[model samples]
Target: MTRAGTAPAVLLVVVGLACQEIGASFAVLLFPQVGPLGMVMLRLVFSAVILLAIARPSVRGRSRSDWTGVLLFGLVLVVMNGLFYLALERLPLGVTVTIEVLGPLTLSIIASRRASAWLWAGLALGGVAALGGGGWERLDPLGVLFALGAAASWAGYILASARVGRAFAKLDGLALAMAAGALLSLPFGIADAGSALLRLDLIAIGAAVAVLSSTIPYAFELIALRRLPAAAFAILMSLAPATAAIAGFVLLGQHLSWLEVVGIALVIAASIGAVRSSSRAARETAEPLA
Candidate 1:
C-alpha cells in the first residue's frame, strides 16, 4: 500500500490496540467481582449479541465444512480468551501480552523460512529473559504457563479465523463463531459468576468491555486489514505490550520496572524485524526471474 493508505490503516490499528488494552484494564477491575472466567463469559456473550445483531448471518444452506470451521474457530476463541484472562489474573497485563505475542512472532518466523528470522527469535528470547530481571521467582510460574497457552491458542485463532472468513461472507463467520463460543462458555460462566452476574451495573460494564475489546476492535481491524499489508499490520500489533502497560499503569495502577519496560521494547523490536523480514522474503519470491 502507498504511504497515504498505510497512514489510515496504521491509525485504525493503533486505535484498536488502545481500545483493547482499555478493555483489558476494565476486565481486571471486574476480576474481584466476577473472576477471570466470568469476565471471559460476559465479554464473549455480549460481543456475540452485538455481532449477531449487526451481521444477522444467514444460517440456511451452509456446508458441513463451513459449520465445522466455525465450531473450531469458536473453540479457539474460548481457549484464547480464557487463558488470556487467567494469565492476566496472575501477571501484569503488559507482561501477559508480551508473552502471548510470541505465538504470532514464531508463526511469522517459520512462515518466512529465512535464516535471519532466527536472529529476531534470539532477541525475543532475551526480552523474555529480561522480563524476569528482578528474579525468575518474581514471575508466577502458573501465570507464565497460562500466557504460553494463550499464545498457542492465539496462533490457532488466527488460522481458524482465516479459514472461517473464507467460508462465510462479511462478519457472518465471526458472528456465528462468537455465538458458539458464548454458548460453550455459558455453563462455566454461570458457575463462576453465580448471582454476581445478576447485577445490572456489572452487566452494563460487561457490554462496554465487549464493545471495546471485541466489537470495535474487530470492525476496525477488519477494515484496516483490507488496506494494509499483513506485515505492516503485524508491525502495528507489536505495540500491544506498550499499550497494555500504559493501560495497566493508568487504569489499574500496575507499574513495571525499567527492566521490564526494556524487555517489552525488545520484544516489540523483534516482532517488527521478524515481520519486515517475512514481507521482504515474500516479495523476493514473487519477483520475476531477472
Candidate 2:
C-alpha cells in the first residue's frame, strides 16, 4: 500500500526530468543570440527565484556544516550548468549530454556490489559507446572539453547533493543551493548577456525556460525523493541520457542511430536492475525476521 502511493510520484519525477531536457532544447531557440553564459545566468537566476518562493528554506537553525554543504553544492551546480551551456554551443545536445552522463554513471557503480550494479554499468557503457559509435563529423575539441568539464562538475554536484540532502530536511538544501548558484552566476551572465538581457521578449523567454527546466523538475525530484530511497532515486535518474536523446530528436531533429537506441535501452535496463537491487537491500536491512 505504501509503495503504491509512492509510485506515481516517482514516475512523475522521471517525466519531469524528461520535460526539463526537452523544454530546454526548445527554449534555446528563444535565445539564439543570448549566447551560452547569458542563458545560463538567466535560467539560474529565475530558477533560484522560483525555488526560493516555493521551498522558502530558512537558515535560522542550520549548522555551519549545513551551510558548507549548500555552498559546495551551489558551486557545483553553477559549474556544471555553465559548462553544459558552453558545450551546447559547439556540440549537439545529445552528444554533450551523453558524455556528461559518465559522471553519474561512475558514481552509481561506486558503493554497491550487487550484480545489478554491473548491469547498470553495462547500460551506462552501451549508451556512451553508442554515442561515440555514431560519431560527430565535426566534433569540436573545445566542445568536448566543456562537456567533460560538465561531467566533472556533475560528479561534484552528485556528491555535494548527497551531503546537502542529508544536511537539510525537505527541499531546504536545494532551495539554498539554487540561491547561491544564482549569485555565483550573476557576474558572468551579465557580462555575456549584456544589455540584450533587458529586452522584454528575452526576459520572458528566459523565465519560461526557468519554469520548465528548473522549477518544475526540482519540485518533482523533491517529491519523488521524499517517497524513495537515495539509491532508488539515483537509479531512476540514470535514465536522463536516454531522455535527453529522445528530447534531442524531437526538439532539435537530431536523429540518433539504432546503436544509440540500443545503448539507451541498455542503460535504462541497468538502472532498473540497480534500483531493484537497492530496494532488495532496503528490505533486508529493515527486516530481520526475513
Candidate 3:
C-alpha cells in the first residue's frame, strides 16, 4: 500500500488504542465500586453480549477440536483480563501495560530466527531494568507479578485466538469464546461486586467500558488490518504504553518518573525492531528461489 493509503489505517489503529486506554481509565474508576475482578466480569459479559448479538454464532455441528479451541481461548481471555485488572488495582496504568507487553515481545523474540532478536531482547531487558529506576521497591512487587502473569496470558491469548480463528468462521469463534469467558468469570464477579452489580448506572458505565475497550477496538482493527500489514499493525500496537501513560495522567492523575518514560520508550523501540526483524525473515523465507 502507498503511504497515503496506509495513513487512514494507521490512524484507525491509534484511535483504537487510545480508546482502549481510555476504557482502562474508566475501569480503574469503577474499581472502587466493583473491584478489579468485578470490573473484568462487567467488561467481558458486556463484550460477549455485544459480540454474540452481532455474530449469533451457531453451536451445531462444530468439531470437538473447535469446541476445545473456543474453550481454551475463553480461558485465556479470562486469565488475561482478570490479571490485567488486578494489576491495574496495584500499579499505574502505564506501568502495568509496559510490563504486560513483555509477553508479546518475548514471543516475537522466540519466533525470530535472526541474531538481532537477542539484541532486541537485551534492549527490552534494559528497558525493564530502567522501569525500576535504581529502586525496584518503588513499584509494587505484587502488582508487577500480576502484570507478568497478564503478560504470559497475553502470549497464550495470541496463540489461542489464532487457533480459534482458523477453526471457526468470522466472529463466531470470538463471540463464543467471549461468552464462555463471561460464564467462567461469573462466580468471581458476583462475589466481588455483590449488590453494586444491581446499580443501573454502574451497569451502563460497564457497558461503555466494554464498548470502548473491546467492541470499538475490534471493529477498528478489523477494518485496519484489511488495509495494513500484520507487521505494521504490530508495530502500531507497541504505542499502547505511551497512550496508556497519557490516559493515566489525564484521567487518573498517575505520574511516571523520567526513568519510567525512558523505559517505555525503550520497550516500544525494541518491540518495533523485533517485529520488523520477524517480518523481514518471513518475507525472505517466502521469496521464490531464482
Each model's lDDT: 0.92, 0.78, 0.95
Task: Give the per-residue lDDT of model 2 (tens digit) for 157-182.
Answer: 87899899888887788889988999
Which of candidates 1 and 2 reaches a greater TM-score? Answer: 1
**Ranking of all predicted structures according to lDDT, beginning with the best and ending with the worst:** 3, 1, 2
Instruction: List model 1 lDDT by residue over 1-290, tens digit each.
Output: 37778888889999999999999999989988888989999999999999999999999999999999999999899899999999999999999999999998888888788999989999999999999856878899999999999999989998999899899999999999999999998887888888999999998998899999999898999889988887888889999999998999999898898889999999999999999999998889889764
- Least well predicted 10-residue stretch by lDDT in candidate 1: 1-10
lDDT of 1 at 290: 42
Report each candidate's C-alpha RMSD, comma-separated, in the order given.
Answer: 1.5, 2.9, 1.1
Query: Which one wins on lDDT?
Result: 3
lDDT of 3 by residue, 192-263 (tens): 999999999999999999999999999999999988989999999999999999999999999899999999
Q: Give the TM-score of candidate 1.
A: 0.97
Better of 1 and 3 by lDDT: 3
lDDT of 3 at 130: 88
Model 3: CA > 4 A from native: 1-4, 288-290
